[model samples]
Target: MTNPERDPESGKLTERYSDEDFLEAVAELEPASTREIAEAVGCSRRNADVRLRKLEEAGEIRKKKVGNSLTWFSVE
Candidate 1:
């Protein structure tokens, strides 16, 4: 199967899996847990944490602390 990402040439995604993977995970998933992103990205939990942290620092992702735990979400 082809990559589920958008083709730069064709300008069409091979499949919605890529976007769905992220969107579905975030849909109504407010106050998201670190584990949620890991499951969404289909990566290691530690790896997910790192990616999320980077995105957050870059302002690509937004995170808020609900008590001791942090709930992450995408800004746009």
Candidate 2:
């Protein structure tokens, strides 16, 4: 997945993150919600959710329902 960032001064597009970035964010903030992960990754919650689901499918992460929200954790 390509996460592009726009330069504030030059208005140029730049790559901001990668799959590893998302993995690191989840590892750092284990048992975190999508919102939290997104905030940490400087992306939108929806974007985080999409990547998170992919990670979960790959068995790199796991998710559990905590009350009304789903919390994600790195798979050790």
Which candidate leads in lDDT?
2
Which 10 residues in a row give candidate 1 its minimum summed lDDT?
A: 15-24
Tell me how far the alpha carbon of residue 24 in candidate 1 is from the true structure, in angstroms, after superposition. Answer: 7.3
lDDT of each prediction vs. the true structure? 0.65, 0.86
Off by over 4 Å in 1: 1-28
Q: Could you give candidate 2's per-residue lDDT for residues 1-76 as a string of tens digits?
A: 3568899999999756687888888888887998999998888988889988998999989999998877999886
Write model 1 residue lDDT over 1-76, tens digit each, in one string.
1155778999887642344454455554756887876676676677667666776687766888888777887686
Query: What are the clash counts of all predictions, listed in order?
Result: 0, 0
In candidate 2, list every pair of residues with a backbone clash. Answer: none
Models 1 onward score TM values of: 0.57, 0.76
Question: RMSD in angstroms, all models?
Answer: 5.9, 5.2
How far residue 76's Cα lies from its native spot in candidate 1, in Å, is: 5.9
